[model samples]
Target: SWLLQVGPEGYIVLPSAGTLEVAGRTLADVRLDVLHRLSALFRGVNIDVRLGRPRTFRIYLTGQVKAPGALQVTGSPRVSDILNSAALQDNASRRHIQVVHPDGSRELTDVERFVRIGDQSMNPWLRDGDVLQVPVANEFVWAEGAFGRPGQIELGLNDSLLTLFRLAGDPLPAAEVGNVLMLHWKDPFKPDSTWLRLDDVYRGTTNPPLRDGDRIYVYYIPQYHLQHEATVVGEVERPGTYPIAEGRNRISDLVKAAHGFLPTADLTSIRVHRLNPGAGEKDPELDRLLRLSRDQLTASEYVKLTTKLSSLREDYRIDWARLQESPKDLDLLLKDGDVVRVERLVPSIRIDGEVRHPGILTFQRGLRIQDYVQQAGGFTDRAWASRIRVTRVVTGQTLPARNVRALDPGDFVWIPERPDKTAWDDSREILTALAQVATVLIAIKSVK
Candidate 1:
């Protein structure tokens, strides 16, 4: 084991060769002496000697590299190796790199050439206490939106749209190559704009020149332009606005685009609400309502008239029955802003009053009042089946149970409780009936 120390003159002192005599020597000389002594001591025997820590030296890595600092590197490291460790920035200039020595001597390293041509001479071994300065290249244009690597890109003197696209890592899939916009600022406030077709540029049909400070914007493809867009809302598997391409633009297409109808969707009635071309046209009926005096009509009547007029002005609704009967009618082209509404299926009918299971039952077609009653475990013992009433949902009219052959969705069936009467109750009922008859005769005489 041999010990080594640095002298005040910045040199290492170690035992000379294999002898005990100490002498100051350069790092290269010390390694050579040790190798010679080791070979002589053991002929044809390879020995692995671990080299101790080398003299600490600092190098400044500034400009266009990540983590610019006074880096401490041991032994002689090549310029390429140092840059690899420091990590070059995206905009770093690899072609015109400079190494400034402590004694003010300068050396140019063409790192780009070394990287491309593998010319080791271009990436010379770095000397201790050297300053590695990377210069930034000039002439750049900004690329924004829908580009893989969008930012400021360096351009050559004769660079064009082709060069810019390549430097920006090309357009993304969502980019609209046919609608790229380029803007050149003439001054701080004035800009000259030009629309470009990158598809044509890429095809070499045109090569538009790009100048410094010019901004290139790649537009994303619009949903409508890429496909005919129609909106489907309510009671569908996935209800939302959908796009239908050239061969796919139809009513069926829109339905498929919406992922089909849900189980709760009303298949019998689908409404297509279209944007009316005459929407801006004034209606004479609405004008008439507007001219009416508010004092002449009650507040409720005025509101009703206004709402009815508004509905008449809106887009017309097409029934789903027409489309269902003729599926080919689905071939009808869907325009932009057209809204297709699939109504939700009506819920079950309600059955209350004296029944074994008095609750709601699922609505089915051609269901009679007795059918619902049967579903509810039949009428209770006290139920007056003859006095049962059926309420219509649309008309809100209560009719006799026997008159209703089938029940509509949302209809209510009610069974009344039977009246229990005694002999005294019969006498009181006869007296009440006579009093009603006497009052009716008196009212008729007064009207006459």
Candidate 2:
């Protein structure tokens, strides 16, 4: 076996054997000449002669073909063979396959005619750089609204409503199977629509064929009642709005659906902000106070009235702790537009300095400075009880421990180191030393 190259002059130049002129010779002539020459040199020996490097050409088959691209051919290939290689798509036009030649000339071939009638004229050999385009079928329709898989679906030349419905995955459960609307867009601004009963079409009563650019919208059954939905936010594993089904979908159920609360969630008081339907309704006593003549009352009385009015507008806070204690309250039904927020636990108070087990302790109501000091294993020997301070989180005020009644959340409890002497005692000792030095100076002057 040897490799050979055909020259630009259309002849193969062989190095081992003398060059055989094949410019005008056919492929059979070249093979026969090689075999005869080998047989003459070695008599009664088997010889195998094969042609190599036939003139290669490429042609492109695009649009609605299974695999559209340039196809390389060693020899002239027929249109049927090229189309078979490309594997035309289902929506490809069978009667309008166009072949555009490199010389700007075009030819239309009916592939279906060639396949059925064996018309050799419709299956001409492809030329180099020819572009074969298989256009998509013009009859296509879009199916949207209440269909399982709704989108623009290409249709066959004679596809009916039944075929289009099956392609769109049929009508969904919520779809009104009795009424289906088909809109034909003959004009861009105006579209003609027709209502067809899908139930009738299913029973083989009347199946209408669809045209190109037709849109089929399946209507849904009308819903008269409202569907409830609630949202849960903050300190939960999954926080989002969830639809409340028609059942016992209470606060606990909503919380469980959100994958429960996080570790840092404050179980003490979970806030549920509800929007009341009668929020516009006012209390008679509050309305009376607003209408009262403020100019007739003294300045102090008017201030008291204003304070009472402001307090009346305050939102009521639900005690989640009490609700958690009562089993019946946990099953309380939730309403639509309700926002349940699980607040994060407050940070523990920091207690560092002279103490046996100095660290932070979880905040609790009614915890005092002494209680926190005792919880930290009491104070050390050098602990200065008089210099103990508390930094309040509310006002950000660092005051003496005696001034604070209770330890608030996020408060810093500090105990300073005990001093050996008081400031007044050090000042008195300095004054005594200065007096002794002055007396010593006066006695020396008297001796002089």
Candidate 3:
């Protein structure tokens, strides 16, 4: 007589239908848990099924997408359909549809228009949705330098996609092609990758289908008209002012653009002496030292001199000794307007106190710290061997007597108090005091 019954273990029993137990899965577990808690409160003759399959698909609209956050989709759909249903973008270019596949590859579909309304003979040079554009035809061009062009007419196509005719004015300056620009399209109707030069594009290069919402950019390459004005001085084959184009020139390029340096020229010492714009307001102090003629310097020269002085006080510095030891220092990036002076290397060190020839001796390149000591006259009779210390003035770093480190610029060699080993006890006492002093000095120096 009962249409349905409740089982003790949270299950639904139907007299006509088969028994359905809460199988501890999906809604079953929830139903069982819920019913098990409320079983005593309800004595029901009919069973109620509370849960079933959801009616929505999980979707997330984000980024430039109009609809954002978690969303639900109902029924089968395509990407276009989903976008439309969600109103994803306001200005979405249907022609530029970009679909991201599950495997992460992207599909770019560009829509093109070929045929026009009254097009006959298959619309000679256009496809559907493509706009007809008027072409600019001209047979003459003008530019400067060795040669110039008055006008030149274009003939039928040759093997070349485009041909550049010399314009009348001056012979085309070497490497200076005048007014050549290129236009680029972001999206073309055809699914091929082909580009045309500006001259050709303006001249109706191809009949490729043009699409809606496509963009084109124009780039120009001006001939080096200024080549005759640019000059390379110091260490170059032709060291003088040479002309170059306005923009097609750089220091490095100009170096190669010219014949390069002579065999005697020092490449590392080469520098650009630009016209100093501020040189007219000469400082009396600087002019006295440089003794450069007024005509020889420009405003830029004075400014550079001032800057060099400033750098000499600060950044333009090198602890040649440290640099020699640490090769990394040599890799410093040189800045424009920087005057790199490669002074002749004069190796020398000062040895004070003790030794026979106790004066400053000129040291040669690759001279060691010991060489300087020997030059300082190899210690007086009372000179203490272990008491020697090399003090670096620039870094304030001091090396001990026994440390065989190389001598650096601004370093002073100090030969300390002697250690007399004539008597065993006296020598021991002196050595102990010296060792104690060295240890204390090292410890005190550590905090620095």
Candidate 4:
């Protein structure tokens, strides 16, 4: 739609509503007036007044603002509405934003206070024909460590440690408020450092006024790095992250702490996944072996490479049954960020490709590859039975028929098929027969 601009003289002229004073008034207040003015003429009508478009006006942007000129702005915008990190000059003071009214009266607003605490008073509505500016900040105090907002903060009038903390969005729970370190730069040459308890500042016991070039460090309380913990998820009674003691706690301890496994939990298939494993640790031999190609590797090197790739990875297959029998030997000792995944029971082996009834068969102990193939209704005519491969679920390794002696419970047997001969293969065979016949005729003629 159409726009009704709020004139500089503090009113919006309408055809029906006449002239309504919109300055210093919300849209709701203006809308109510329109309803009252229209009700006097019409018997009963629905009056829906929506903000079609915001009015535009120019304001003086002087001082330390990046663009210190007359800037055109629309709508009833606040101080922060027109300001961003990029809009300010490098050393511009955000806390001390000066707004000079048309009457030559000044009002100070802290842009950071509004952002940190959401105090509407700190971010006032912009008026037309006002001089807005942010002075070059000469006094700044730095805050670091466990604060919600930690950086260089512009010092303001009557600013204390409380003001600094408030402007910094308060200290984190891990902050050592009992001992806050401050570096005072009273003299340009070197500096004086002191430690003060924040509790004393709150109690009005020791609150010294902060100065320019002062850097305060809010140290985090020790042990904030966290202890060794493991996360147990999926099919567990209580799925969550639980802290563990390195030598004392085992897989069983973690399971007990989690209130044991759920009814659907596959105890046979539970795994302990260590975080990163031996990341950042150097293994020259292993690294060299892993980088080498298959043909470049020796027999011993290939064995080492395969072992490292499979056995030395992040996840470890747990022997939950063996752990129960011999807890001291089989129970895994979990470290920090270790994840214990427990999945639901799946009691069938899958037979795929070149089989008449290629589907899942109920897993049985002491079953071989042939037994699984028999269960899947033998094989199709095109089946390459000799080149069969079995995939073990426990180790997730695909083994050839020669390497794989017997099938495991959760093994997947894949019987591949022979590819059909194309038209090119038939043509090549006929061309070879013709060339052989021509060669024999030439040989016979030479003999004659």
Give the lDDT of residue 285 in candidate 4: 85
- Strongest candidate by lDDT: 4
Error at 345, model 3, angstroms: 1.7
Clashes per candidate (backbone, < 3 Å): 0, 0, 51, 0
* Tens-place lDDT digits, model 3, residues 38-111: 45555673445564332344544444456556555653333444444245344443223344443455443221
lDDT of each: 0.75, 0.77, 0.45, 0.83
Answer with 3 or 4, whichever has the higher TM-score. Answer: 4
Displacement of residue 186 (Cα, Å) in model 2 is: 6.5
Over the stretch 9-43, how does candidate 4's per-residue lDDT look in tens digits?
Answer: 88878666588887788779888987788678765
TM-score on alpha carbons, each prediction: 0.39, 0.39, 0.22, 0.64
Give candidate 4's root-mean-square deviation (CA, Å): 11.0
- Candidate number with the higher TM-score (1 or 4): 4
lDDT of 1 by residue, 32-141 (tens): 76667667766787744344765567899999989898999886577887886248887787756899998899887766445543667668777778999987866567
